[model samples]
Target: MRTSRTELLLGRTLLVVALVLTVLPLLSMLSAALQPADRNPTGLSWPSDPQWINFVTAFQVGHVWQLMGSSALIVLGVVPASLLFATLAGYALGGLRVRGGRAVLVFLVLGLTIPFEALIIPLYYQAQAMGTLNTQWAIVFPLIGLFMPFSVFWMRAHFVNVPVELSEAARVDGASIWQEFRRIQLPLATPALSALAILLFLWTWNQFLLPVVLVANPLDRTVAGALTFFQGQYYSSIPLLNAGALIIITPAIVVFLIFQRQFIKALLQGAVKG
Candidate 1:
């Protein structure tokens, strides 16, 4: 009983520490953003007079709405398509047991080790030859392809853990592989799919490097990518910069909040499934 109590106390203490560590920087940024835009604020000190209007001004000047739209467009394009392909590949490898699937899975896992940064140069030339540079496609295609390796691995993990009896039963009922995945395995894999969707959404929305490198037009780039251009123009206005940064992250926060229940469900489902 004493050991259990001690472990519980330690865990709770760690959780509190983590909560503070996560929240403290956000609070400091908020404090800094509330100060006058003209003066450079130091540390976490609150201003005598708060300039809440800084956010409003920053939104207009930073083109937050347009940035949001651009990001939304990219996310919609990337997430659904990536999920579909990853799901198909994962099912083939994990559920169907395709010929040479193990070797292919090894290569896909290896792809994960090859950092995105290394491929940027080759991708740049490829996009140029394809005439996609300076366009949203430049950002969209690379993100989808780059994301595949991990996404496939993730889905494969879920499908592998699924009971083989489920597929065997479906096969006995004269169901094709397609029907088995569509009707039986797919429904059971909801938690995995939902969790993967949220992750892809976040990664696609927060994508900065690919957009910056591939899309020359700032307006065509994601909000996070556009932040660099925004920073260049408003480097002197610290408050505006902080406000704009907060504005940029708001959509992601909203997304997480809206889907938080599904996210948690996925985690719990995984625990039980495993």
Candidate 2:
């Protein structure tokens, strides 16, 4: 009983520490954003006037709405494409029988080993050649491709946990393969799908490097890319930059918060079942 109490205390302490670690930077950024322009470059300090207008300025002058729109386009396109392709491919690789199944699975796994940085140059030239460069599709296509290997691997693991009897029963009932997958397997795979959707949304939203190389104009840049415009070679508008950063990060935070319970439940379901 004494040892259990001590363990509980330790766990609480650890949780508090983790919370502090996670929140410190966020608090600092907010503090900085609120600080007056005159107070910015003198290191960190409490806000004197607490200018709330910086957010508005960031949104308007900083081209935040355009960035948000671009980011949204990428996320909307990439998320569905990634999930559909990943789930279908994963289902095939995990549950269905096909010639070269193992070989195809191996090839997909090999994709996970190759880092994105290595392919950026080739991808850039290819996008340019294909006339997709500077377009939202350039960023969307590459992100979908980059995220697929991991999504497939994860969804495959989830699909493996589903009982084969379900598919077999559907088959016996004269259901076609498409009907079986669409009606039975896809419904059962919702938790994994939700989890994957949240993850893919976040990944695509936060993407900077790909957008940097693929897009040259601010009109086509993502929120992540737009944050870079706040800095100069010598000086940066720290307050405005922090405000922009906050604006950029807010959607993702709200997304996770709104779906947090679902996200956790899905994670638990995937872990236990898979």
- Name the best candidate (by TM-score): 1
> If candidate 1 were superposed on the true structure by all CA atoms, what would the RMSD be?
2.0
Candidate 1, overall lDDT?
0.87
On residues 1-274, what C-alpha lDDT tens digit does candidate 1 reach at each position? Answer: 2579889999999999999998898889899999998889899988889999999988888777888899999999999999999999998898888999999999998999997899999999999999999889888898999999999998898888888898888889999988888899889888888888999998998888888889887888898854564566577888888888888888888888898887887777756644
Query: What tens-digit string does per-residue lDDT give for candidate 2 at 39-59?
Result: 554455667678898788777
Clashing residue pairs for model 2: none
- 251 in model 1: Cα distance from truth in Å? 0.9
Q: In angstroms, give how far residue 32 of model 1 lies from its true place.
A: 0.7
How well does candidate 2 score on lDDT at residue 255? 93
Taking every candidate in turn, the Cα RMSD to the unseen true structure, in Å, is 2.0, 2.7
